[model samples]
Target: MLLSHDITILSPALALEDCEFPAIFNFGDSNSDTGGLAASLILPPPPYGETYFHMPAGRFSDGRLIIDFLAKSLGHPFLSAYLDSLGANFSHGANFATGSSTIRLPNRILPAPGGYSPFTLTIQYSQFLQLKNRSQLIRHRGGIFASLMPKEEYFSKALYTFDIGQNDLGEGFFDNQTLQEVNASVPDIMSKFSTNIKKIYDFGARSFWIHNTGPIGCLPYVLATYPSAQKDEVGCAKSYNEVAQHFNHKLRVAIVQLRKDLPLATFTYVDVYSVKYSLYKEPKRYGFELPLVACCGYGGKYNFNSSAECGGTVEVNGSQIFVGSCKRPSARVNWDGIHYTEAAAKFVFDKISTGAFSDPPFPLKQACHRNLD
Candidate 1:
């Protein structure tokens, strides 16, 4: 119930869980971003946070991102954005996610054709390193600042979650890179991702929950762009989804190797792509409608206009046009053509949290434990 600057703190979330994860340090893009992008650059306008926060809460969705739900489920308040200095409380942990983030830096750091962030995975890793060292320094001061910072022991006991790489594919696709060119970049992209994972593992992070990239081709933006491209039963671009599968395949392989290298770490590779794909494939079965359409967008067959995103004002010959949301967002899968709605996110979190889609077959509650086999 408490909406902090960078995150929404579940009012009764202070009673820590029996799972023993005192904090959660997340890294990734907008899927799990609390407010890192909003704090650094442009804030997501009204209706962005309407479903949950009822205001502009700095999230890209119409409500809670998966990270928000993950925090609440773990009996912790929402994570404060490491970039957000205003009214931030990092007692539990911090989020280093930003919209449009990629494992490799984009050719241009400028705002996307819409808006892309400058916080790449490397930059997020750098921020994480800074927080790990400086939080202790501030806590050593022993004041209100100390109260807001995470305890020294939380670093080793915290859950480390990642939900990036989607943007890496998006960036390549949008830049007019051929399908083969984007697919070819998977290995190097994953190498950097694995390198960052290893870097964090060296920093005493034991519990890692990494999400493979989702179906980028199913997104309305991509669908709109390649309208004539081949479509599956679900109407998603088959080739594009194949690229996502390629990315996930490389990512899983990297994770398996990482486990062999970092013996002490417990890495839970969550197959969120399948969960998300199923929703789009059978929207009605998942209590969703218009799986490919943007609930908050303007124009076209998918209710998405790339030039005019959700909750934005566009000019039409000197007159302003307010791009808004649909009345039934909870029933829609896509939020702003790029992100998932709160409802769809909840579905993803519910499925993945069960461990049914996870490697090592362990639920979120048992992510701290390593698999014997």
Candidate 2:
């Protein structure tokens, strides 16, 4: 199996390797959400998915997300949301990501009008467990597979990707918690995350692609919400970024420990923070004009207003507020205050698939190969 020291020989061409894995089981929050939240709750209105999909596809961004690009790179069709019942197809895989989801269960109070959401990571896992059981039943009855694809092989060969945890920190800050207070909860947050991963691991999943939380301190919403905090050298929220860094460190360590425990398992930790930070630090280098501002939002610095949601306007004190979306979304990095544009998502996926950010440093395609002895 490829290891960290093998980076010297790895090439960008590695991304072109033949596609691997039978399917992909994805779990995350808005960052990787396709249409689960929209189908389960309310469909996000126009401008939310106008870029590529030309309609509200339930993605938090204007177009595709990093997970979409990842699926495309693997030569698989876009994974359908497990909750989307309208012509939903699980042939390729199922996406369980929902907007405003947290990894730790009890549900922290978010600044949003709803206070908190029931679609937490734990709920997603429960859905996955149910899917697995149903798949097993289908296999047993030879109803769909005709005894061809056993449930075990279906899960064992599928690639499992996680892009969660941002909401855990975001909700904490929204509730006026300090950096120290949020940092204190990192261990428990990661412990729950690790436990969920183990649940999947025990259920026949062998390949894992885990995306660490990104540099949340630089998000437009964070900057707009916490203006008093000192900015980093790169103009991001220094203290909040430190919290994200701390969490990422703990998460990486936990993944390494997981690898040690499951010797035959393939776990790839994708360093989304560094990749995203690089774009912010040097937006021009990545063809991005505005890296720290929202491409769509109401009037304010970075075009973001904390109270006003994207794509629609709300009446504030009998005044009609109009929130607008950028036409040139490809040139922008951020889509809304918290989500990223499809172009930015594609860029990150390109970088990640090159194997530079992955532990052991192998392209995603090659990383999916079974490491059986």
Candidate 3:
């Protein structure tokens, strides 16, 4: 049985009624990536952003992600990728997320070889710092960075959000580590995460909204990777979900310690696992027809073919391969095996903004509204 605390203790007053922020600085993996990967690498092929953007926007989903929804709810325009140099506007803050990023160096305890990513959390922070320094230099030279948004205004007033850590665990499993070994690495994983937050906090960021890892076991990718001996009543791999639950528990404890360490910081740990698991438990409630299957791909029970990724084809034996996307992404929860559909992302954003699953129980609006210096 999954152990969880009652989140119903939240007060109605804490719900996101009316709140706003000048900007939001996001850091994470593809779950919240707007276009960072696109700006860096070849953008994801078609069907990647067909739901909302109506074109490939480098998001792993079929449309907008949680970060996009949160930005819209806060009245800020969609954030541009920090790495996208062409048309990025950092005035409303920048997205530093990449598609296959991990919170820590992959060599810590796991055998994963992902420590070489240019878009790791550390690299993202370096990019942010460079951007901040440039803004400062421009300010000193009497150049307006973004109309009224000087370097100080953007970092001081903007909300710092994160939806990372999935890859840290994902890569471990990818490297063929057992679930027990991956579960044991959670502490080291979160320590690096907390350290990264401290680096940003040192740069004058005080408001944070960190999302915990969701049900990795329930993801079609995980299901495909580890052919389960048996599935739970909801058709999810129980062992994998348990791993997520364990990671989330340790992460919550770390967040509490982080809160205690930074008295002035308003840190909110978003319970992504529970809220997302709810959608899986009752997909019909959220208007989802297939909660556990990918909306794209081919040659699998969940339409998630490893040989043929969401849109790209792999070369094998001098033959061309291809996989197609579903016509209706709106009815699906999972997108392309690993990522969530835009509809599922919106459902999560709506619930989390209401402050029900937030640690210390404060609506995002109130949390951001409080620490405006």
Predicted candidate 1, C-alpha RMSD: 7.7
Task: Return the clash pairs for model 2, or none.
Answer: none
For all the candidates, what are their Cα RMSDs to the real structure?
7.7, 4.0, 6.1
| Index of the highest-TM-score prediction | 1
TM-score of each: 0.93, 0.90, 0.88
> Model 2: residues >4 Å from true position, as ranges?
1-19, 106-114, 139-152, 315-321, 369-373
Task: Give lDDT tens digits, candidate 2, residues 155-178.
Answer: 888889999999899878887777
If ranked by TM-score, best first, what sequence of candidates would result?
1, 2, 3
Look at candidate 3 and tell me the lDDT of residue 248: 88
Clashes of 3: 0
Error of 3 at 265 (Å): 0.6
